[model samples]
Target chain A: MKLGFLVDLNLCMGCKGCEVACKVENEVPLSSWRLRVKYIDIGTFPDSSRNFTPLRCNHCENAPCERICPVSALHYLENGIVNVDSARCIGCAGCMMACPYGAIYMDPETNTADKCTYCAHRIESGMMPACVVACPVEANIFGDIEDDSSYISRYIMEHQGGVQVRKPEKHTNPKHFYVGGGNQTLNPLAHQRIEGYGLFNNITHLKHVGDPHHGILDRFLAPFAAHKAVDNKSFMDFEQKKADSHDKSHENEGGH
Target chain B: MVEHGINATNAVVTMDAALPGIIWGWMITLNMWAKSIGTGVVLISAFLLYRHKKESMPSIRWIMPLISFVALNVFLLFTLVDLHQPLRMVNIFFHPHWTSAITVGAWMASLFTGLITLLLAIGLLDAYPDCARHNEIAKTVRANSELYEKFYPFVVFLAIPVTLYTAVIMAESSARELWQAPTELMQMLLAAFMAGSAALVMVSDKWSQEVRKDLALVLAMAVFFSFVMYMGEYFFSFKSAEAEVTLEYVHSGGEYNVQFWMAMVLGFIAPFFLAVSTMKSDNKTILRFAAILALIGLYLAKDVWLKIPQMLPLS
Candidate 1:
């Protein structure tokens, strides 16, 4: 009875169909996504390759996120989906720490944590996730893993492809699987890079929109510290000349 | 040094930060409730002692403090509920997940509260010999002195874990660079020791010299442990990028940040020095203030540790 989505990265068109579909289906506010596509650029410009990774909740069988939620706000269904109950979510973010894959997101509008629920609302009515329907490349395949004849099961058995499971040491036992994939490698912070969707963050929260890797101190303090010194070399030079010449002219007039 | 860049990509770009954020937030919310509860627990104990006028308070002594603690635990229960959709928290208990720490904490708080209540009832039974129904139950149990002595020891033991659990919950989260260390466990343990001793001293009339000495020693040990652990964690983090953010986080002196400093000064250092120097003093007010400070510090420490981590990026 375990229901989940199997995203095939090999067939993905690099279009954020699933992201858009999830937003529309869930009425998710701007910049919040149940699932997202990550683009990784590998090698040099002349001989480079771009990798796209589809990220979603694996719905781990041994969900650590489920273990840490103090109120039991999140629970696993008999069908093996690890979904959050918004009614109880106090907006604490414990599940965020427990989730190693980083699959959960907080929706600012409602101030509640969000994730791919596997479209539990629609699935109960026997409908698939909107992303599955909208995937132009047919990259997203959805069905019950328990059903032996299901497409996902067959795909897994034939190719033995599995989802990009990071931090398996954490043991969340995710149900979502990725097939035939190569994308995202390395920690984004390790490289001192931050890229959120444009206009996603309110302008107030985002002022100096740039990269953080210019300096070690800058990378760490970028969020909380003051902006760098403005480029005023020309202004300084003009001020210095005025100070010298104006002072001399004033002195001569006084003497006369 | 602030790069002023707000556009870096997330290592776990797709991770739903809100989910874990909600859960951790739930634990901290409990700490929030604990802060108020802890304050009331100590203050009420002081008031109760004042009212009883240096007499052997058979039933009323433990009853008041335990009541306050139970209320705190109940507030903790509500926090667990708050983690869910604003309305559907009942499902968690109906379909319980036993392996989760929150569930474990819930059960532990419940069991501890229940035990405290039982201890109080037994004490009450021992107090009134004419309350035949209950005295009969307690008489077969042990000496009245023995019966009188039953619960305080367990409170000490239980308080240890209860105090540490909140910190553990915060520290176990790798997400917050602040809570990721073991120092939180140390902080809780020290604060609990200080709180417990202060509580014990408050309730007693003819203080046991032996118990006083033991408490003094425990107080000293706790002070040392608390300082060592707090410093150890800081030393490690002091050089890290996360540490820089943490320093900035502290400097911001957000409500929780202010709380942490107060906890350090009033909770640990003040009482620590007092415990070392004022061990022989008859002035009880100082001890009470120390306890109050320690408890306040502990609560603030918990809040700061929990909230700081939510601000970090996993990558």
Candidate 2:
């Protein structure tokens, strides 16, 4: 039925309710998350604006993770939900490298790759995803986009040309769509200056802990970590200009 | 350099951005290393066997098969240990994914191992004709030397594919530009030959002048290929910002600068000179040292090649 998510950025309040709800419902470890809210700050002080984008698995049509998986541990269901068969997983982590969205996480507990299953178990029981139900602003919409009568289908039709999918250039043909002003938050490369504060600070921990050469070994292996010096300033500036032009064109198309 | 400061003060914050880390770690690297050595030994031995009617090098004739067999087993062992569900490896045979390079590689490795083991048994039977009188399989193999000789070429053909499969696994990862580069397979092939030849020369005590010359030629080709691949990757500018950053990290005295330079100098430059010099002198120790250096350098090169690509944040 091609079940998908349509996150409306206009209504989101950066409350982080979905993030917490997802964690509680999934029983995800404190060190990892199935979903997260990205905060993007645009412009300077007085002219500044903020955008909150909910990030999760795109459940792509051309799933690279599924293709790259050596043991066929990551597979797609009939409804198009890409799910990981933990029992079959070899913990090779090939899927983690293949996923362009960074949706998958290596669960050290299970020693297997894990990610959002679109709450497939809950959906099979005829319940909405926990994140959608708990979203205070009702910003997280989930339904069968293929079904014309579904809310997601109507929402997509209503938004029409305004819908945005992150990294469309990746050609994953992501099922997750964002409506309204999510340009800044959707493009990860667009974040000019990132402050590792709040939940974002965990990114640093993730980088360290996820590293194969962390702990005592890092003393000897630290020099090989030089690729960490990614100069994204110029790239971010370019992306910011591109996003601005996109916003300008949308503004010309009339207000949301 | 892009400053990744911890203080949030006034900037945007991404809670779940992609982090830098190795997805496939040392286990995969070791597996590839062992597989290359195993395959290369058999490949070179097969070349020698086809060209020379008699056993020109008595030591290499018996040693090469034994080494190839042991190395192949090591490759298999590492691969199994790396799996989360080691028992589930059999699932690949039952539920094969034809599209997956890893699936093909697994099958290729299995076939290569089986063929090499059989070939080793045949070689052992031939060497100790008295042992063949006792065992039926050994007797059949020893009696059917002509048949085994005919199949040697086919085994050699399988060895090349099995060796290249290691490289193809990395190159198939479309998400990592550093791996997906067209020259990755070529680089890997060259390195494998270099490593394999170096290892062969290190263990073999007595070899004919022609055998030494052949090994020298192989080492030279390896160095030449490395130069071409490195220049192509290092000199050419990448279109993608992420790719450019990754290439810069590899070449621009970044974190892996020491390892990279070490690989170039020790693995390629030094070995090239040592191998070339062997043509004028019959110094076995020089060749052995060169082989040891090349082996170490190739491993370092692979370590850099595998680790840096993963360190680049994909999301």
The candidate scoring highest on TM-score is 2
Evaluated on chain B only, what are the TM-scores of all the candidate structures, in order? 0.66, 0.89
**Which lDDT tens digits does candidate 1 get at residues B22-115?**
2344345455445334433443344344444434444444455565466566665556444323233444466555655555665666666666
What is residue B72's positional error in candidate 2, in angstroms? 1.9
**Model 1 TM-score, all chains together:** 0.63
- Cα lDDT tens digits for candidate 1, A1-256: 8876677767886688888888778876544557777655544446555556677787888876777776666888888888788766654566776666667765544445778888888888888888899899888998888998998888778766455554444555667777665424434343222345222331212111122112324433434666533222432477765876877866644321
The CAPRI-style docking tier of model 2 reads incorrect
User: Of all true interface contacts, what fraction is found in model 1?
Assistant: 0.21
Flag clash pairs in model 2: A90-B84
Off by over 4 Å in 1: A1-14, A29-32, A37-54, A69-80, A83-97, A105-114, A120-128, A139-163, A176-188, A191-256, B1-93, B118-187, B199-214, B237-262, B280-289
Q: How big is the positional error of residue B152 in model 2, measured in Å on the Cα after superposition? A: 1.6
TM-score of each: 0.63, 0.84
